[model samples]
Structure formats: structure tokens, C-alpha cells
Target: MMVNCCGLLTSQKEPVPLKSVEVELEVRDHVATVVSTLSYENKEDKPLEAVFVFPLPGDAAVCHFSAQIGQMQIVAEVKEKQEAREEYDDALSSGQQAFLLEESEQSPDIFSLSVGSLPPGESASIRLEYVTELAVQADDGLRFCLPAVLNPRYQPQGSGGGEGGNVQVTSVQVTSVPASLVPYSLSFSARVSSPRPVSKVESNCPLDPLQYLNTEQTQTTVKLAAGHKFDRDVELLIYYKDAHQPTAVVEAGRASSEPGTLMGDPVMMLSLYPEFPQAVMSSVASCGEFVFLLDRSGSMQGARMKSAMDTLLLLLKSLPMGCYFNIHSFGSSYEHIFPESVEYNQKTMEEALKNVAEMKANLGGTEILKPLKHIYSQPCIPSQPRQLFVFTDGEVGNTKDVINLVKQNSGSHRCFSFGIGEGASSALINGLAKEGGGHAQFITGTDRMQPKVMQSLRFALQPAVQDISVKWDLPKGVSVIDLSPPITALFQGQRSLVYAQLTGQGSEASEGCVTVRYSLAGHPSQNQLHFSLKPAEDTGLTVHRLAARTLIRSLEMEKREWRGQEDGGDKKKKVVELSVQSGVSSAFTAFIAVNKGNSEVIQGPLVRRNVPTPMVMACGMRRQCVPMSYDASPVMNMMALRQAEPCSLKKRSLPKQPPRDPLLQLVSLQKASGCWVLDPDLAAALGKTSEEVEKPKPASVNQEVWATILALIWLHGFKMDAQEEWELLAMKAVSWLQAQKASCVTECVDAGNALLGCTVQKDVLGL
Candidate 1:
């Protein structure tokens, strides 16, 4: 009954006086707005400064921040980060209460919030709001994840210093407390509405039964169930009947803002979901350079390591023949499966599979950038499109730096990224896919990684969409400016959002149209949306804030690209300007609030408190696999990291975890040629003895061909519900048999079906 919490920086042994957290989430279509109110009370004998470093969704844009201390309510304003920091420090020195919120330069998703000079017996409430677009999951569900702030994010070596150092957050030791003795409480609620009917809402946490707000089922409300731990991530998968419907929202400008500015001008958020023709989608390309980059970091122990091995099995078997492929595993350094890219035929695939089976979570630390450089440095094979598949736990410290590298080499290949566990950095996963023009998938909780990884693999095999353009067709004389960057690549059922500024005056009744055109393989496709120029009152500043964030990220990237140039500072200035204008939090800007009304003298020295990363449960007992805290200073933090033990989880008293997946056991028996050898392992995976399974083999067919047939029938007949996960593997097996042109395939299939107690037809097995 111990809840996990991310302990913050504190001068004292006890944590900060955080009492409760209240969250309200609203989802309209694919966009979500979350408002969190944290209640704190100073129960200490003296004044305390509370600095909390926490995680937010990587792509969320903070648009509002404020604090309520006693009867005084102080609204914060966005300013330059340094200026805000100085003001907060100055306020604390003056013995006045102040609040500061700044995004971490090391990772945009990590934010530092400092509440200074809270006198004893005083209470304060902090309100924070942000908006983000939900990512589509493998099953067409829109996924929204509230990350667990308590999980440790491993900092790469030589990081956490200088201007954008990881020094802002220093973890302190904290222990698990029973639920009955917990210091804080959490309240969470969500309201959802979409153009399509909401089919259902699911979460890893227990939730109250969803209540429909309307008969159409488009509107509903849900909240966490009673006694929820509020630990781990709160992941919600919202399924809709027709989620791909194209829609547009035009939000009204702020009444008090300048007309020419981002906040004053009406912003149109157009959503385009293109469903490609099945004819094109069904045709998988036979040629591509497939590079799989894996994280063998020590943190990928236990369940994570097993998940990676299972996913690799699927990926290795799913490769199309004649394609070039290689496997790279990285931690402190990287190792490759081959000297270079090799043709994925019988011989090469077996060598790769054998080596992959021997992989372990022994590599030292999470050092992703090094291996990425190695992958990108390789020259692309001629006549083969480069498709890079990266799998990681996303514990790296340099999120932006890694993303920038991906962006620089984006033109060379498409990168499909998979975040492997509960705490994967959404920023890293989303950024890689966005910049590399591919798709991103996340595997969380007990979810099978194979289906999601296989989905991305399918996307990688699809013909690339090129020559993309967004055409604005607004009312004449009412000019428009596109706030979003150009369209990159579009996949079936994925939502593409385009935000634009409507500058010139237009008739309220007049329509504004936008069209997105792209070439898929050789065929041209276009999707368009038309909306009235009249502002949408209910939407308020949601669309505008989202637009501002898009522009800010682009500017930040530009600022990085132009660094050391004369215009570098100018570009940075523009980013700060826009951030202030739109009232959105950015890397260059922070939100600061000061309580000028407090006139009390200093009670004690200022101290900051953060929620400590909690001790995780291990081996069915309350134990820690590694140190959960570091020194609360930049220098000491680095020292702690260097001295910290790798999480090999080598506890002497603990039993070994079952690593091999049951399904993977079957997949592991697959030969490089996609055929299963008639062995005891194969029979065991089939839940039979070798003597029993071998009895059904046709004399004309070889052992491998018959074993492969039985595997296909087992997958189709018994595991049809998991078709998506093993569809490619089954296809590979059938292809191997088809290559033999064995007329006895029918006899083998029927006999294998009898042995496996499955009545699967040969056609159903895709033979």
C-alpha cells in the first residue's frame, strides 16, 4: 500500500509540506487540457522553501500558472527564465512568498517549481494547466498518460552541468509509507468529448464506471476509483467509433490582446486523418535497410529485458526477404550483430537470431546518442529505403540533444521508435517519429510489446508518402499564416493537426478552407477541411496556446541549429517574445508569481523540498533495486550517479525472475528461414512431446516444413485472437513453405491441425 512519489530537493530530512493534489482533465476531440491544483501546508516550525522537480507530458504546453496563499491570489506571468529565477531568489531574500516554474533545459518534460518563504502554519495552493494532443495507440485508441514523477531518469555521463545542466533537480532519500500513514492525497477526474462516439475508456489504474453525459455517447466523465494508489502512470486509452473524422476548430482571440499578435488573432486547429487505400497498404515493400537499435542498459532488467527479447524475436522473423538488416545493442557502448548490413536471408537471419538470443541487460548505462550516431553514420544502401527501428526504455538525460540529432539526419531515413516501459520519455519517442517521418508506439504495464512493435514495423514497410504540402484557401483579402510546419508523412488512422493564424478581417459567415496534399508511392491523395471564420467561443485559448507551443518548439530547434551564429540570439529572443505573447511556458521563458503583500521578516534560512523517488517493491517484498536518491546539488548529483551501482538487481536473497516469455519460447524455435525445426523445444511450445508432434509429419515433407506448418496452424487456430501480434511471423512461415512449392503442404497442414486439435484451413494460415 505504499505510493510512489518523486521526492524533491530539500535541506531537511523530511519531505516538503505537500498535502494533496487535485487534477481535472478535459478532452475535446484529440486535444486534452489538464489542470492540476497542488495544496501545500507548512507544518514545520520555521519557513520552508519548497522546490519540486516533476514530469509532465513531453509535448504539453503550459498556458496557465498561479498560486493562492491565504486570501491573496497571485497570477503568474511568463518572463525570461533567468529573470524569473532572479526575481524568485530576490523575493525569498526579502522574506516574501514567491513562486517560480521553469522547464528543464535537459528535458522539456521535466519542470522545476519553487515555492519560497512559506511561513509556519501557512497554506498555499498551486494551479498549473497545460494542453497536448493525444497520441493514437496501436488499436486506434487515443492514449493519454500521466507519468509517475517518482521514477528515476538516468542521466548520461558528463551531463547535469552548465546553463542547461541537470543540477536543477537533485533527488533526496525518501522511504515508502503505508497508505494509511501517507501524507498526501490525490483526486483525479476527466471529461471527454469527441466528434465520434466514445466507444470506451480504459486505464491501467482502477477507474469508476464511465458515465455518459449525453445520449450520443460522445460525452462522458470518469475518475479514479476509491483507494487508488495514484502510483505509476495513469494511462487512459479512449476508444472512439470513428476517431479519424476530419475536424476544425477556430478559437476566438483574447479580447484584451493586440490584434496582430498570436493571442489576438483567431487560430484554426484543423485535424486531418487520412485513410490510405487498402490496395496500397496491402503491398509491402520487399526492399529496405532495417536497422534495429536496442538499449541494453542495466535498467532494462527483469520484465523489460524479457519484453525486448520478445519484441526482437517478432522483428527478426518479420523481416521481408532480400532486405538489408542489422541489430545494434547499446548502453555505455554499442555492439552490432554484423560487420555491416547483411541481406536478411536464411544464413544471416539465423546468425542474428542466435546472437540476439544471447543478449543480456549487462550494458552499463543509458547512452543512446552514441549508438544513434553509429547508425546514422552508416551509408544507405542503394535501391533500399532506410528504415531505422529504435527500442529503448527512454531513461536518457539529454532528450532534446538526442532529438536534434535525429532531426539533422532525418532526411536520410525514416525512424520508427518504441518506448519499452512505463516511464519511457514521450518526448523522445514522439520527437523521433515526428522528425524522422515515421510512427511512435509505447508499451506500458502488462501490455504486450509485440503487437505495438509489429504495428510500427508494418508502418516502416509501407511506401513512403512524399511531396507533402498544406494549401490554405481562406476568404479573399483575409490572409492566413500557417503556424504548423509542413506535413511530413501521413499514416492510416493517424491524426494530423494543422494550426494556422487568421490575420485579415473576414465575414463571420464566410468559410475558410485548408487542403493537405501528398503523394503516396505513385498515387496522389488529398484531404481538405472547411470551417466558418467565426470564432469558437467554447474553445477559448486552447487552439491559440497549442499554436504558440508548435511555433516555440520550431524556434527552439532553429535556435539550436543557428547556435553561435549572429542571429542565434535573435532567434532566441523571438522564442521568448512569442512565449510571453502567448503566455505559454517555453525553455527560454518561465512563469513567476510574487506575493508582495507578505511583509513578515525572515523566520529561518530558505530550504527547498521535493517529493523523493520512492523505493520500488522488488521480489514480492519491500526493497529497493538501487539507490532511489542522489545528493541535492549538481556536483553531488553527478558524483552520486558515478558511484551508483548498475541495476543488475543482484540481490543475494531474491529469486531469479522468469525472463523467457511463453510466446517467445515458441518464436525462439523458428529457424532463420522462418521454418520451425522439429525439436523438443518446439513440441514443448506446442504443449506436446516430440514423439507426439512428430507423429503427424508427412513423409514427403521435411521435418522443418511440417513443423513450420504446425506452428502456423497453432497460431491461426488457437491464437487467432492475437493475430495482429503474430501475423507477420505466420506469414513468414507460410512464405518459407510456399518457396518450397511443396504440393504436400495441404497434407502437412491437415495432419498438423489434427495433432494440434485445430481445424484451421490452409488458406486461413495464409498458405
Candidate 2:
């Protein structure tokens, strides 16, 4: 059997053989020996600088070391450096005796351990005494890399333990540094060829890279400015059955702007919550109304709901007995079992917990807004911080409306949404949290739901910042040009700091400071705190504008889709105008926005009464369908001209669903107040007929198809050839959807509208 191991970086070299390796089982008279020696004759013509990588436990400590080989000695010390450097250094330092090594006199940097030399044809031996403080075995491991050393010849002895005994490399990491830093284009690859077929592939990359890819199918564009610096680790894994093909790569370079405009609002980039410097066992007193709005819809009936209920129970049990709590169950209807401020006595809490456990998924519709609004409307302690946790798959009638309600109803309370399934709407949950000045979390896998939800709830309930303000006290000559809204402070563990982008060049400054102040809930408060600053080293007017514009485009896209108007319905209404006014085609607005680096724009109602502009008229198609076809665009062309960039549109799954009338089949899939088709392909499948098979619309559309339509409208407006025309069909389908039992809401009208009736129903049900 092959012992498989995994690591970060990888290589093409064979695993070193365990020559004369010994595993001692006994430690007698303090003369214990655990020699795990591996030797190999240098077959290649280059010296070997082997880095013995180890995945030591976080609390592991090296005690002593002894090595015998020539006059060469080893060096070791505790490294306190960036995590990246620490990993690299740890691998090289492992196995070398601590006492005999050339131990550093000063505190170790991240890459601290070193061995001077193991000359060619020279054998070296070392003994190390260390103990790992980890309570669990899984936390201990080591990793290393051996690069070709000075002028020497050697080939690492492959795990030549027969065909069945292949050398297994553990904790391997193959990475690439930027060419700007390394001046080289080195690629890393790993091979995990075994007698058995390959089973799995793994990947790890930074959040920015993943966001750039937009794996969530969002039309959002992530931009990097010219002078701005960014570093990210991108890991790609390709698993294959063949030998030597388990390869991965990390690509890094200058990234240009993504096309398709999303208008952005000036926002606070970072939170300014004060860190709870020290935690003590103080009286964890609780006040205010604590509402637990649970998703008890039919979808939540299985392990999803079960896990959520158990988690909620665990949380309820853990709450200090002094806190007030309420339980609300929502589905087709909602039931608030307890009053707004239920006393948390032993009996009351136990009964509430029982009620929660007994609560079952009933009805179907997810009436989220009503419960949230109800919580907001209820009278409660005005000064105490209110917290409402919505635990569900986030399958709601109207997410936008619920968010709006929460925002509007916010008095002294915060709204937190917990998504409990893979299909949970990230946008909805995240938007709700953002809009409500709270936090949103998505919990996947039933087994992990309880722990994840509890963790999120714990943080959500802990307020780190309140009444936060960030002010830029500029120099004498400096002026305040523009700034985005200070973002709501989010808690990071127990501390919070706010960050914002300030744009304005100063000729000279007597003094400059960014002042931040916020209340720390149960902690202390401050006002007008100042952060001194100097002229920004990285200041690019063009890149800043572009970044701002790109953000605006993304926000606009989000808003446009939020207003679900199928059939290019309201395309003529310059409802929301991106600031690129001089463009010939509305589609070019995205290009112009990028070209000019302007982010400020107006959005509200695309008033139809506004003077009919040629661009709007030409592009005035509802459900702006961004062509899924891999074709050139003015924006792409502009990007190419500016930076020689290339972007390809991913192909649609239903290539044949476009041309044909999709309404015919769509109407059939509608079930009264229960099932509604959100996927365009499913709608198209429902719309198509056997007779239409000869000229069936390209493949059918999915929910993403509708999104693409909206994106196209954002770009070209309501302009498309007959073959690409699907707006009318979409309109018909939306009408059918509107008339359907209202379980489904398109990006057209938002999940909020569909839930309005549910809100009424919930109200009637005494939610």
C-alpha cells in the first residue's frame, strides 16, 4: 500500500530513500536512540543543498542536537518571522542536532535555521532532542525542499524499495515568486504516481485570486491599480492516473481591470472596532431582545435543519441565564413561541429549547422579511444591543426586502444571517449582513453546521465597535477631494481597526492624521483618535480612479439585477446611468469608465422621462443579455489596447435554448406556491416542444442565463440579433413566474418582492 502524503510546494525529483534507517522502540538508561538516517551517492553533477522540511507543531520546541561530519556544524534557533518564511526555514532546520548546530546568537528571523556545509562524498550524522506540545497527533508533521547545492554531483536516492514501496513525500510545497522579485520564471510541479489510480486533487489560493475568477458566477470585477502592490498564493492541482502528472502552478503578475461595469459606492474599506485587549471571567450579563429566526421550510427538514436546531439549542444552553431570548420559526408561515423578551429562567429556557427542538419544517415558502421586520418593530430595551440570528439555507421569499426591512428597522439591534447549505445565497446573506450592520456566514455540510453557526453567532453577538468615525485631518494645503463611506466595523477576533482610501495630493503638510473613534460595547470608548501619516508612496490618480470606477460598475450591476425587469422592460428609462456619458453605445460605458478612471455616478430610478439619448435608446433592452458568446467587445478591445488583455466568455450549458420560445415549456414547471423554475435551461426545457426540435433555441437558459441577459443589457442595452433574442421569452416566463405560487423570484424583482405576500401570511400566522 502506498503511504500518501500532501504538502504545499512540490517538485519533480524523486523522494529520498531511507538508507540504514532505524526506528528505536525503547529508551533505556537515558541512552535512547531514534536514528532515521537516509544516505545517497550524488549521481548528478551538482552539489545538493537539501532542506529538511518539517511540519512541527505550533508549540514544538527543539532541545539539543549533535552532528558528526568534517568540521561542519549546524545552527538552530526559534524563528519569529512571517508565516511564509517560517515554513521554509522550519523544513531546513528539522533533524539537525540543536547543540552541535551553529545556533544563532540573536532572535531567529522567520528563515532562521542553517547548516554550513556537507561537502561532497561526506557523511553527516546528527541527533536531536525535542518535544511537541500538541495534544493531538494530527498537528505534527515536517516538510522540506533540497535544492542543488554548490559545485557537486549527486542524485537523491529514489525510494527504491521495489515497485510496491514508492517513496512518499509529505508536506511538500512547490511555489513561485513573482518575476519582479526573483527575476526568473520558475514553475513547480509534483508527481504522485502510484500503482493505484489517482483519487483526489487539492488547491489553495488567496481570496483575491478566487474573487478575480468569480467562481460564484457573479459579474463583479476585481481590479488592481498600476502602482498598487498585491501578493497572492495561487495553487492549482491536476490529478491524473499516469505517473508524474500530479502537477500544480501558482501564477502571479500584473492584473488588469475586469470588464462589465459594476458601479460602486464610496465605502469604508476597513472596520474600526477596538480590540478587547484582555478577556476576563466577568459577569456575562445579557439584555435586549434576542430573536432566533429559524428557517423551518421544507428544504430545512433534513440534516440541515436538524443540525441548525441542535446548534441553536447548544447556544441557548450556553447563554448566561440572565439573557433574554425569543424563538421564531418560519416556513410557509411563522410562529413566535415566546414573546419579544422572554425571561431566561431554568424552566423558561428549557421550555424554549424544547420548543425549538420540536419545531419542524412546515409549509414551503421562506418568509424571511416578515420575521425580521417583526423583530425590528418590537419594543425592547433601547440602549441594549439587540441581536437577531436568521438560521436557514437563506432560501427566502425576498432577500432584498428582508435586508431593507432589517436596515430600516434597525434601532439598537443588529441582524446576522447564517446560511446552512451549499445552495444558500451568498449574495443575499452577505448583503443582509452588510446592509444590517451585522455579519453573514455560510455553513456547509450538515455535520459542521452546528460548530460553524455557533462560532459565527458568538462573534456576531460580541460587539467590537459602535458609533465609529474615521476622519482625515489633512495638512494645511491638503484638501479633501473625495472619499467612500466609512465601512461598518467588523470584528476580527476581539479587536478592530478601520482602513480607508484617501485621495488628495498635498503640496505641503504641517500635519496629517486619520482619526478613528468607536465604542467597544462592553468595553471602553474613545473619540477622534488620530493616526499620523505622510505622503502616500504609492499615489496614482489614474489607477485610483479606475479602481473606484470598477467598484462602482460592480455595485451598479448588483443593483440592476436586483431590479428584475424581464423583457428588457425599463431599458429606455435611464434608471441608473454610469458616468461615462460620451460613449456611443451604452456597452462602451464599461470601457469608458475603465479608460477615464471615474467612479462617481448617479443611480436611483432610471427615469423614463429623461431626454431620450441615442445610446440609451439603442441599448434600451430589458434584461440586458450579455452575450455568452466568446466575442470581442468594446470594453475588451479597450482593455486590449490599454494593457493587451484578453478575456473569454464561458460557454453556456444550453447552447440550443436561445432561439426557440421558452415560455411554452416554462409554464408547465410552475407549481402553485411551491415550485418555480429559477434556472433558465429548466425554463427553456419547460418552454420547448417536440415540434420545435428542428429549430430549438440554442441549449436552454439557466438562472445564470438571466444574469447574463442583465449583464448584456448593462453592456449593449436591449440590443441583440434574432438568434440571440430571449428577452420576450424571458418576459413571458417572468409573467408566468409572477403568477406562479411565488416561491421563486428572479434577479429582476429581488427575493424581497416575492416574500411580501409571505410577509402578510407570516403576520397572519402571528410570526
Every model's TM-score? 0.92, 0.39
Residue lDDT tens for model 2, 640-695: 22221112123535334244333223322322221233444442453333333222
- Candidate 1 has its poorest 10 consecutive residues by lDDT at 614-623
- Report the number of the highest-TM-score candidate: 1
The whole-model lDDT of each prediction reads 0.79, 0.35
How big is the positional error of residue 701 in model 2, measured in Å on the Cα after superposition? 71
User: RMSD in angstroms, all models?
Assistant: 3.9, 29.0
Per-residue error (Å), model 2, residue 184: 36
Model 1, span 1-767: residue lDDT tens: 65334543222347558877888999988899999998988876788887666678989999999999878899999999889988988888888888998887767777777788888888999999999999887688999988753344556666553311132332222223222234567788999998789999999889999999999999999999987765567899999997777888888889999998889988888888887888998777888999999888765766777778878888887888889999999977799999789998878887888898799776766778888988888898998999999898786777788888988998889999998766677888898899888889888778888888888888888888888898878887798888987888788777888888889887889997778788998899988777788877688788999999999998886665886788888889999999999899898899999998777776678766655432222112123323334444434533443334434434666566665655667877777667888889899898999899887687777888888888888777777677787787777777789888887878887798789898988888777
